[model samples]
Target: MAVEQNSLIENYSIVIVNVAVAVIHYQDQYLLGFRAASQHQGNRYEFVGGKIDAHETATQALIREVSEETGIDIANNIAVKLGRLHHDYGDKRVCLQVYRIEVTAQQYQQYKNLSQGLEGQKLTWVEKQKLLAGDYDLPAANKTILAWLQLPTQISITYPLEHFNNASNPMTVWVQYHQEHLQIGALVYIRIKETGTEESINQLLHLRNDIKAIIPYNFYTEKADNTVINRQIVARHLTQAQLMQCSNGIAKNDIPDFIIASSLPLVVSCHDKESIDAANQLAKACLKHQLAPVIGIFLAPVEYTQTHPDTSPLGWEAWSRLAELADIPVIGLGGLSPVMSDQAMLHGGVAVAGIRQFFK
Candidate 1:
């Protein structure tokens, strides 16, 4: 699945397709079907879904697809929009609207013994870790799906100050708060926006062993490569420009393997469709190069941010549009509260993220 291949689509005006793919999750396992060798992109493990009918919504198509393929009805289940992917298979241009629905133990067990889909396609349950590790052979576009799967729905990003705005030792307070949050299983992005990110990450790295962090790339300069940053809390953030650089490197086969190979995952701060495209391209490059793909992206300014006062927020409507373009998980950031996670998910975001609201 990680082998690199050359398949270029020259024509840009081909008819586009809408496909509804489901990632049915149960106890850290995802249900997948093994395509027959006669099918396109055959012999690979794939999620069960099909082209959406002209008369149906994405949800309607997904419910129908899952039923026809797996004999499992998802009409009553809550299908959360995971991400959207637009890919060209040369023969077909497809826009995949991916959704994830969790099944209970009873439901999983009921279908677990089936061994094959209703269409006679082989079915297997890939473990969460194996899927995340890029173990199973999947279709090329599924590289983005693997990256998105690594992410937790809830994320917490640190601010210079959350509730303690007046503290002389605000970074200290942030350190304590972030450590506590991480210990409790909150996936926190270690960013100290006010006093600078470097020193803050250095401090956090030394304080604890259990800290799960996503460091950011320094927004101040292009000189700082993947090697420079503490690889901290931004778990180093990539701008669209930076992701473009990686994409270019993948083309030339000259990019360093550290970022592509590291335990640290790339998370981009995307404000528009173009940025999401850049990130998606980088994910494809990683899969091509047999390296670790981008983990996810942060789509920000869901509301006005007091920290970044000048940058306007992308409200729910605009944010949803951008999220629909992202093939990776999109965390709704800026001026958001934990309570808004559901709202974010409803509007195509994987989760809501923030400093002021979430930290408090």
Candidate 2:
């Protein structure tokens, strides 16, 4: 946790605007507004929110903003912090205090009946698939918000693909785990560690919305169709090495084929600041192409693991420091459990991922 944040606002001569933003939601639908052509971020759709006042907390500001924008009051709705995003738009910089508001059935209906914003903006409920497809023109600044919306608080990754090959029914345990997690609204990532096993890829693809698929770079490069994306599965998973290949920039060099064809967000595995920097560069490159950016990275080995007894764990303090370097979301991996989600978020991560604890 950072006790003090040294800002360049004074040095850079930029006016920083602090605003409270919300992603109002109900099940798979999100409340959005189609901005008038005359307004800022004109003609593009945006989440419902407003600027915060000096005396108001982010939550208070959001509640007031929601009430002002729409007739419904969200005083009792659960608003989870998806983390903050600060953008420098050259003229002025805006620091967004973004939150996710999970609305109930009646609230969703109330908003649905309200055809237009109280201020004359058009209101609509867009499905998750449409948002994933970039069907609506959202400000590029909201790229990370899109990533946060796509990610789950708890991620369940399957054991190595080859480990299940010997079993008569390779998908048996996976199916069981998928069902269990699905019941709880959690997601499953079927990791493909082996190259020659193409059948596993097909089986994983068949998962559709059942299990949000996340495949390794090699597997995606070889078998991912990309012709039509379901928007449910994560686009691709970049290993640290694969990510390093484009360290210079995705501009002059050939952007990876997977990235070029992707309509879905990407996931990267990062450890140190160097890898995180690489992922950040990749994300900026994706944003330029109107492609979904690196939604999050799996920052690993926060604690000692039997898999790698020799290597030292990051522990909590060092892990938090590493997480601070990543502007995007971070999922703490390696020797962690679901119970540690709050600890991970408190330290700058969005969630924790592991096979043992999640599967158990």
Candidate 3:
């Protein structure tokens, strides 16, 4: 079994262990068990499995847990190892060894009789079609099982905000897969408006020299002077769709670790309350879907409006609450001098994002 340690604040360490999970499907319906309320993730739907006890091999543990939980005596020869799953539950982690098992009619009947009136565990057979409909709130480990069971599809990539908007450094994005580093793919979407100027776009191209293909921003403007601005805005909107489509297209494609919307404040005025509200809603929805985390960048103006109330920079409290509810990481942007990174972290952000401050 592989061991992984995840470090959290205050010296807390999360430990993950590897074990095996068995899937017994009959007529396209997979067997599942509801965990007892007393168990760590009580009441959640999970595959039939448990931690491998001392001196026991993975196969032995799988056999023992299946018998203990489902009362099914699976013949050793009938169990087939499928693959492995790595899961982290904040406090602990588990690498699941997956297996597919076959059960005969006679064995099912005998197991049914033995499992009757069992305490804490509720067993059921769920159709694969219904399972794919996303009806149940399953544990992370179970989700890995389902992914393995499903047909192979394109990889999905998601680019969150934190990766790109480093205040002190010119914008850059990191990509990852299964928490491992990966290079960007050929087709990349660059938001022209977010890049602001042709020079900036060229600079970005230089930074991502490895990329051979890029979908440039096409502006929409009736006037000559505003052509660039229009194109940028159009590019921004298109980039959003491109990012989403890329994320849903291939699971193997490395998800961008961050997206740099702009080094400057994208919203020129705080008075656009509707835009702020819409952004918040979108962020919330993404979080609900387990999409990438969002970081709001607040590039401060050179001068402050004396008439405005003395509010914390960028209404930090409001954004912090929204991110917290969605379990999304938020990094404060704008006027984030190097010294303020600590303060931003204290305010529930992973870190501060800034060009001047980041490089400094």
Candidate 4:
């Protein structure tokens, strides 16, 4: 009877395995294919690849799958592992390992013409903007992979500066820091802490010179709803009160028109599950207003000095689960530092973000 019970459990349980997916990028666009209309997720668009064979590496599986699906041989070394996603489809559970496959412009064009759907699926090249704006419907599980692709690998946030205007050589500090970490693809965010007032507004402009000195890629000011500056990504950090305001704005279709017209991408911060849900809701609202939404979360507290000692950290497993739920690029915050950047990516973070990590 015990043997029969064990057999029943084995037979009823779902099979677990890995699926390799290719994210082929060319000319600021990505390659995606439509699933066959008869399959389980038929008539939907997805990154193309197949199952990983027994004892096969992710790269080996990617090369084989790309060739079989698109008739293009992706060089093994050129395929960079982005991240992995754990998904369950009731009867089957899978770890979808995604890779970024690189190809030359001429090679991409030639393959675009020559590539045939080996599995009777339709293939198309899509711009990143279209993908973010919901131009195509993707399978629920694959959304996390798309979001991961949108995030920068490194992020640096500023520490609160109450005496920046009186300090000497502030710009030098910024210049030296940028020179040291220039190659890391870092985005700088100037944290905004203020109430509406003339003195506070004037004080805010003190860092403008230092900000301008940094290279003009991915630099932005946070909590920027009141002012629109040049060459900076305007942002808003939502608290409980502001979140209710956002909800009302979305419901009344009253999110300001400037959001849709602004070229700067929007970043939203989430501290807990309630804020995470609010961020998700705010993202959809941002999309409706033609704004790009990126979610930031405080997943862990590394040191007692950083926050409450009794507060439990989310750790890697919980962080990954919460990030998957975001369905948009997520920046890992809280206790993260430069050393844990790679580990952050492993657990589904688009980038490692912190105040002390990049600033003193």
Judged by lDDT against the true structure, how good is candidate 1? 0.72
Better of 1 and 4 by lDDT: 1
Model 2 pairs in collision: none
lDDT of 2 by residue, 1-360 (tens): 221122236566766677778898788888888888887778888888877776677778889998888776888876666655666666666767677787889888766666698887788888888886788888757766876777877887777644556777766655544545442445666565655655545544454445566766556543356533344456568888878877765646467776777665778888799998787677666755566677778888899976567878989899888877775778899898889987887677778888778864
Residues 24-129, model 1: lDDT tens digits: 9887988989999999899899988998877778888889999999988888877777766666577876777788888877788898776888889999887899
Q: Which one wins by TM-score: 1 or 4?
A: 1
Give candidates' CA RMSD values in order. Answer: 6.3, 5.4, 18.7, 9.8
lDDT per residue as tens, model 3, 182-257: 1343222332333334544444434545432122323222245543333322112223333334343223434333
lDDT of 2 at 301: 88
Backbone clashes for every candidate come to 13, 0, 23, 0
Q: Tens digit of lDDT per residue, candidate 4, span 204-262?
A: 33434233111111223334553533432334344434555566666667775544554
lDDT of 2 at 308: 60
Q: Assess every candidate by TM-score.
A: 0.74, 0.69, 0.40, 0.52
State the lDDT at 177 in candidate 2. 44
lDDT of 3 at 336: 48
